[model samples]
Target: MDLNISNIIIASLGLVGAMIGGFLSYKASKSATQDSIKAQSEIYNKTRELENRRIFENKRTSAKIIYIDFLNAIDEGLNIVKEQKRQHVGRAPNLLPMNTAYSSIIVSLSEELNPEELSVINRLYGIMEKVRHDILNLDYILGTYDHIEFDYRILLVEVFGNNYKEMIETNLEYITRDLIVEKIDREYKKVFEKLRVLGELNTYGN
Candidate 1:
């Protein structure tokens, strides 16, 4: 009877030890799974941060160049317009090939540029186009292109002389550089200042 009891006790002890080992193993497996999930979450966050940083760097580099060029073009174009207005003549070609500078800024950064800023640029372009049209049409109607230099002049004094110039000048006086250019400059400066953001535009029209 003693031997039999001893054997039973040993079997019970073995079963209990097996149960304990299983519980510890279950706990270890759960902990490992939790760690794995945590590791993946951290990796995902780091990858996203790197991606965002790269995007910002791209905007700071490429977009910055475009904005500066556009600004310079505006400044130079305005100066030329002011000069021509002083002489009442269009001596230079198409006011500095405005189409190129205008298209470059608008097209390349089409998606990135701000809606309000885009509106202002478009408005300025429209005004400038109207002024060009009137001057060029006058050149064609007067046959001044053939006789005199096909120049953009507030008055075709070369063709009509001073006395006849008043009639043509009246139509353009409202849209002259003096009358409208300052407003264009102001609006443009406001739009550009926003794009001049160093950190994120946070730059370029966010």
Candidate 2:
């Protein structure tokens, strides 16, 4: 009888030890799984942050290049208009090339921009195009007469003179001394402001 009781106690202790060991092992496995999940999450977050930073940097660089190109086109256009004004007898090839360059930049900017920025840029471009047309028409009329007529002078004053004055008073700067250059400068300012707004929105979105 004594031997049987001792055997039973020993078996009971063995079963209890096994249960405790199993509980400890399960706890350790759960902890290891949680640690792995946390490590993966940290890695994913870091990768995402780096990608976002790269995208932002690329966008900023592109914007700067476009802005510089726009400024250069405006400067070239103004120089052409000034030369035409001074010579009074010839059509300026400079204007055509500058216009082409400006158009290309506008197209590129439109592709790069979001819808809101594109809309503003388009409106500004349309306004500048009308101004350019007016200048070209006036140039033709002046060339035909070899002198400015009253009617053509009136058209020029209305389209270029008054508009230029308004732009200057509003703090816009032109690339040339000629007032007609204000047309391009004002339009460039509008584009710049719209781009700035778009950039802010992009940053906030990110």
Candidate 3:
């Protein structure tokens, strides 16, 4: 009976040990799973951060290019205006190319841009549109009545007269090429300042 009791005791001890081992194993597995989940969460957050940075950089780079291109277009348009004045005749070519660049800027980073930047850029575009429309109007007049005989000045007076020229002058004075360029420089400086602060402009060349 003592021997049997000893065997029974040994079996019970073995069973209890097995149960204890199983509990520890379960706890270890749970801890490992929690650690794995935590690691994945951290990795996901880092990935998201990297993605956001990339997108912001792309927008900034695009904005820089657009700003430069638009300024160059303004320069070209100014040259055209000077040429028109020197020649004293001929219709101005459209400034539509600059307008297109502005459109691209709006599409790419409209939401990202500060409200004041948006307003200034849009106002610049509006001025360009007016200039383009005027150029087109002049082209239409020249095309439609090129054969008319008279001094170009007299012909213009006869065709469009004081009212049209006065209106055109007013529009031109309000949004002169110099004014457009000045505004662009001012607004671009502000934008670049912000980009510099954010360190967004540094990544542009690469």
Predicted structure with the largest lDDT when compared to the true one: 3
Worst 10 residues of 3 by lDDT: 147-156
Tens digit per residue, CA lDDT, model 1, 142-201: 444321122223212221233323424344335433332223345554655554663244
Q: How do the residues 1-206 of candidate 3 rate in per-residue lDDT, one tens digit apiece?
A: 99999999999999999999999999999999999999999999999999998977767766666555444445445345333443544543443454355566566676676788777556655655555555455545436322121222232232223332442344444654334433434445575445444334432312
Residue 66 miss distance in model 2 (angstroms): 1.9
lDDT of 2 by residue, 1-206 (tens): 99999999999899999999999999999999999999999999999999988866655554554444344434434334333443653544233222434444455555566666556555444544544554466545335422222222332333344364444343224334233333534544455655545355331112
Ten-residue stretch with the least lDDT total in model 1:
146-155
**Sort by TM-score, top down from the best:** 3, 2, 1
> Model 2 clash pairs?
none
Error of 1 at 39 (Å): 1.5
- The C-alpha stretches of model 1 lying farther than 4 A from their native spots are 78-114, 121-184, 198-206
Largest TM-score belongs to which candidate? 3
lDDT of 3: 0.54
User: Each prediction's TM-score against the native?
Assistant: 0.49, 0.52, 0.55
Q: Regarding TM-score, does 2 or 3 come out ahead? A: 3
Residue 15 of model 2 has an lDDT of: 91
